[model samples]
Target: MTVYKTYTIGVTITGAANGIGPILQNNLGDDLFIPAITTGLTSFTFSTPVLDGAAYSVTQRIRAKAPSQDCSSITPVSGTVNGADVTVSITCVLSTVVPKFAFVTNSAADTVSAFNIDGVSGNLTAATPTPTTASGAVPSAVFVDPTGQFAYVTNKDANSVTVYGINPDSGVLTVIDADGATADFQPSIATGYAPMSIAVHPSGKFAYVANELNLAGGNSISAYSINITSGALTAIDADGATDGNQASIATGVEPYAITIDPLGKFAYVANYASYNVSAYTIDQITGALTPVADSPFAAGSNTHSIVIDPTGKYAYAANGGGDISAYSIGGAGALTQIVCANGVLTTCSGSNYVAGSAPRSIAVDPYTGLYAYVANSGGGVSAFGIDPATGALSAIDADAATPGDNLTIAAGSVPISINVDPSGQFVYVANLFSDNISVYSIGVGGALTPLPTLSLSTGSGPTSVTTTQ
Candidate 1:
């Protein structure tokens, strides 16, 4: 005989404004409220119906109107009521707008703040800072291991990678390794120049870093073997053998971003200076890379970012010169550019689909592989509906609305990076010039609508945003 088991996932909602707070209270059956709207002095609680044998994780998200104020001081009180287990918490108190999981500014003197998310209460609490020695002048992109035992951060300015041991109970970080001194064992011990991005393979056996150095003959990619037990990096191939030659294999220019295929058998790099992308075949045994056949596919002018769709059938690139191009990836890693109805490049061949000046980044919605978003530095984001069969793009709703639609939102001057949450329910844009984050809700039909905007703390230049599990 086989026994059946089930688990329950719960969610709670909160707000920073008076009108929305009351509306949320009325919509949710069990809810709580703080007496005043005063900054750094508000508290609230809410509960979900008792769910027996339900296994779930709780997270708290905040929607604030102001960007500079800190929301970390608020605390939550959550526990079991009757026989039901629950939790309460507060949200991240940031001076600038932070994407759900993107790297925020952190330094030895100024550590990025942490928060405790309550699965039961739908709240967050300020967490103690994990110690570090590197100057926090640059922000660190955060990536967690598959086993949840450790976390890794790529510090841009520090030109170093930091490892942290995760607390199982609270999901907070504790510094374990500050530099590559004790990375997982491989070969080389030297660090890559100006490491800007880090991605851990889906297998949890290796990690790759994208060095954004532009100095003559200085830029390249780095590979490492992951220490399963220690969560440290062990350099693999030295002499930059697998490093994409510090230029795009196709365009022969500087590379900026890197991503591995979902199958873990291949990798792709975005060539910032070459206006193209390079593909490489990965050695399953050693995690080393070799250029794929017919690689260095022409992407677009100043191609700086690339993302493979969830299905891995198509690849998209954000052309910094002002457009987004799509390509159909052949089974052998070859790229075939998709042509528009008018027989021109589908990315920006028409007036309606023309992207704003200087498109910086692109992110796809996980739930529906048919939708994608582009962050245009000229201001606002561009929404596109992907043609599944052709890998073509058709703009949705005429560029959508700018950062501020409902009520004059102060989006940092130049919007640089845009990311969609794992759930595909929200989209966050990082504005470099304005130093703010713009939030938007994704509609059922793949359209983007604006949400409340928030500013970062003083001196925080928001760059990239990612979500953590």
Candidate 2:
């Protein structure tokens, strides 16, 4: 005897109508019409047991008889059956609704571009009045805060950090005054000679800027306290005095980029001329920085960019010599080099991953924490898989080349910066020479499939790229 079980589904219709009915369908092409009720809740049962590891969708009828009439819509709230009992929730309403956005920074054009994100396809459409001008010059880096309420741009040429209030729904940018614009404070705010990179703490309470040029005493990291209410910034006092010099933490020569861990407990600066990464323990109370043990960790030549995995366990540096330096983050925020041994991370010779030509920037996929991607300034992009437990990088075959060098794919000419979207669904690369943004869809096992049709045209010298979707 083939005994079958039953699954019970309950429907709750908001704004329940008097004389309307909704239909429910299963994968087997069977429809069940649920009668309207004066009360909001009703229950229906199906006699067939659901197969394990199989997906079954129960859709609701959304048709209306007359325009603007009281027609109820149906939706699957929950549906599952187990043991001797079955339970599910099917929701219905008159109608339901929603929206999304993306942003791009153009360095040469001195502007920022906004786009509307298509939820289904992840495609971008230019927003009205596209390419908003930057308030400062040579905007080298842009950071949209975690709250998605504010944006910070570091203008290398102007030696200033520009603040902007973000539109939550439309992804628009409007400059905010950080120097006594909202509240009266001591002197106006400013950055170093060439602020090359900017990073906001996860707590949304501090912002760090890397001053890349050699000013008299200006080659340092600037610290600022964020005004959460107004989305403004105020310089932190280095000595905890109002009259003392503004907070400036000195680093190796020509620091090019900075990154803070997701935990907000540590920060790192990649020094281009110094060939090292400066590590620091963040002062949570004052936003000041203190050097960690073995302060400056040695890296390859022309260290350009640094990134920490979402797990907070490993850190990587993209060097100009076509290789990536791997490090194991210590408890006190110190970095220890991770030497690769026979495709695994171990204490061995050569503590780096050979990458594409002139690797400039790198990003770790936040979803699996198992992959890292680098943008090669010489030409294309490179991919590597991270050993989660050991923090060593294993080369992922570009197509299926087993036991080969690091996998490389032609993305664009002179790809400078690369970043993964928040959803971990797509990767964007800013090609300096090509003057366009290349879009790639992330696939299983960390493969990148280029969506050539979706390549977005940008202003000249799109040196940096970031997203706030």
Candidate 3:
């Protein structure tokens, strides 16, 4: 059956005269142009034939010259099409600001939850329609770009990375639809099986994922070049396929997590089964990975997570054996285990702070670069004060000199992942077994005081937490 719909798209220019631009439809090409709107509003009628029950989108744009003679976006930028005749009204406003957001991945529910951080209290408020489908199975890790415009989630069960376009103002995640003109068709990009972790470079040009299960090669890491303007990812391969045809780079056994340094010069992977950290130098222009000298450096037994300091001078690894390993990073991205006399880094003369049962995630303070936190699966979080000169780790609680004084603070059951906000004032933890998130406020000397609540309820089995503010 042939279906036809007649729709009028209305464009209104509030302040400008004779605004010029194009009106775009998702499936249809740019077939109409905005006439001179000397008055406030103008309407154009078109009788388009489309398949019944098909979805389309309509948006409007206008050209202005205050900043430059470029097309400025007017909202509501896109309108929903349901194969029915409808009118879309767009008001062109000049100023709009993007807001900060925090995201958590619910592993068992296979969803992603978003929240807005309270500016003054550092509390998280659930976004309207809080949880959104993560678009893949077992969303294990999530990372937001430095530009704050896009987010990527690694799905362990589905072996794909779901790309989401972040709503600038409302702090929501929407999967990019199958519209090349408006959005991209690649909402979820294929990756190696059992992808565990994701890391975006500080330059915002590259992203890497640690695949836990070996596909064709041994356990591998996937590299991708990020599109700056659109936030789309293109796989980098030597064969030159436009799509993601790059073969995954081999890594140590059971690569659990990956991280990039602040300078964007190197990448690191923590191998759980191999008990080592793999270091690689990242090519600036091409985003290729080259192993550094003695790339798989020895770390604690069953190291699971790694994080680099903001200064790029040191790195830390959390191990399953309830210890955090310290290392001094070289200029060429080599890892040197800090000489420990008695489990201590032995520079300022301190021992490795013993954390909860199994440490899974580690986070560093971005601003001061002196504080670090780890989420221990046993039941709580471990806080530490990092020595800037010798790259040593020290517990922050009262008994600083005592060995195994992890300065542990209570959290919900099975705290699997943790993070600190940009201001360094608050900390968030994702509790897997309890399906809740614990909030804490950082105090003097990295002391954590839990907020007066049990915890924030989340979807099923919240496994990871990340924030941008």
Per-model CA lDDT versus the true structure: 0.56, 0.72, 0.72
- Per-residue lDDT over 98-153 for candidate 2, one digit per residue giving the tens place of the 0 to 100 score: 12555566777877666666554556677666446555777788887755788888
> What is the descending lDDT order?
3, 2, 1
Better of 2 and 3 by lDDT: 3
All candidates: TM-score: 0.65, 0.74, 0.73
Query: Lowest summed-lDDT stretch of 10 residues in model 2?
Result: 61-70
lDDT of model 1 at position 47: 42
**Clashes by residue pair, model 3:** 344-351
Candidate of highest TM-score: 2
lDDT per residue as tens, model 3, 175-232:
8631123343767777776999999876566788899975563388887877756777
Steric clashes per prediction: 31, 0, 1
For model 1, residues 1-469, the per-residue Cα lDDT tens digits are: 9654322223232334221121112122232322223323344444444444443333222222222123332443233333454444444332332222323334322343334432222123434454222323365455566445766666666666666776765555666743344535422233456666567765567787776777532356677878666677777762224353222122236677777665566678888887888887767667777777877888778877788776667888888888877788887777777654532323445322356677888888754577888887776677777887777777665224543222112245777777776456666676765655566677765666565444433225556655443
Top candidate (lDDT):
3
